[model samples]
Target: MSASHYHICSRNIGKPVEIRTRDGRVHRGIIHRVDNRMVYLRPLPQRNYGGYGYGWGWWCGFGWGVALGAIVGLALLPWFFW
Candidate 1:
């Protein structure tokens, strides 16, 4: 499938997604949102918090709800910060 075919598309709004970071790690979560170059995921309970790929992005796995929200919000509006 093409990159745009990821589960984060509009039709799969509430579906689950699997993310493989650049470091060979994996995460599974709800497809919160997807932008041109990044995928925002609210990682599943079992696969939350672990090694992350090196890149400009946000990640949340366990109890850091507030931090997670902040990152996702920023990613959604990258123009403001970029």
Candidate 2:
């Protein structure tokens, strides 16, 4: 499929899609909820990551908190330290 054809929009809700988190884990599920900047998902049983917490399993993926924080820090270094 073409990249333009895959663009996500309002119609994506209720459709099945796969999500690849920061750590490379994949979650396939229906698009249960969507807002301007976020998606709330309810994964299918077969695609589950096997241990649930924060609505995700151990194999689901890692959070973006650390990565994004480090990126922000690096971006500020040139301005504040240099």
Candidate 3:
């Protein structure tokens, strides 16, 4: 994904979204936060066999982590050069 995609998604914070990764994995959840490169998602609660609701909590994928690191490095490029 590109930076613009991240920016656009960030604007939709708290809204439901379906993210399709490059590996063809799909994740459905409510967007929590979006930075220069990574989107945080909070999974929706699911009902178990016991009739109790369980939350999957939050998750950040490996691809997103790499992207975020790259973005942070680029953002600090100017500081390092100067």
Candidate 4:
């Protein structure tokens, strides 16, 4: 499971993705980086916090890490929005 998560996260580096974890939490962000056990996601704005383009580039700091094993689903989005 983690192997596939690693594969998917690695493949989508720098691309936008929506990840669902076993904990029932959903994360929408750019695939920042991946490691042996974690996928870092640079989260987009939720509503009015930062909006689109807030941390949309490489200049943005590294995102929080989510354990690969905790991830149950992953998908790439066509575009980013609030």
The TM-score leader among the candidates is 4
**Tens-digit lDDT track for model 1 on 1-82?**
3243433244564455444443455555555666555455564334335586454445555311111212221112222222
Worst 10 residues of 1 by lDDT: 64-73
lDDT of 3 by residue, 6-38 (tens): 665667776665555555556655666777757
How many Å off is the CA of 72 in candidate 3?
Answer: 21
Ranking by TM-score: 4, 3, 2, 1
- Residues 48-67, model 2: lDDT tens digits: 46675455233254222112
For candidate 1, report its TM-score: 0.40
For residue 68, what is the lDDT in candidate 2?
19
Q: Candidate 2's error at 55, in angstroms?
A: 24
Q: Candidate 4: list runs displaced more than 4 Å.
A: 45-59, 80-82
Q: Comparing candidate 1 with candidate 2, which one achieves the higher lDDT?
A: 1
Ranking by lDDT: 4, 3, 1, 2
| Candidate 4, 4-50: lDDT as tens digits | 88998899898888899999999888888899989998876444446
What is the model-wide C-alpha lDDT for candidate 1?
0.41
- Which lDDT values do the candidates have, in the order given? 0.41, 0.39, 0.51, 0.83
Error of 3 at 79 (Å): 43
Residue 38 miss distance in model 1 (angstroms)? 1.2
Alpha-carbon shift of residue 26 in model 2 (angstroms): 0.9
With a 3 Å backbone cut-off (N, CA, C), the pairs that clash in candidate 3 are none
**What is the TM-score of each predicted model, taking all chains together?**
0.40, 0.40, 0.54, 0.76
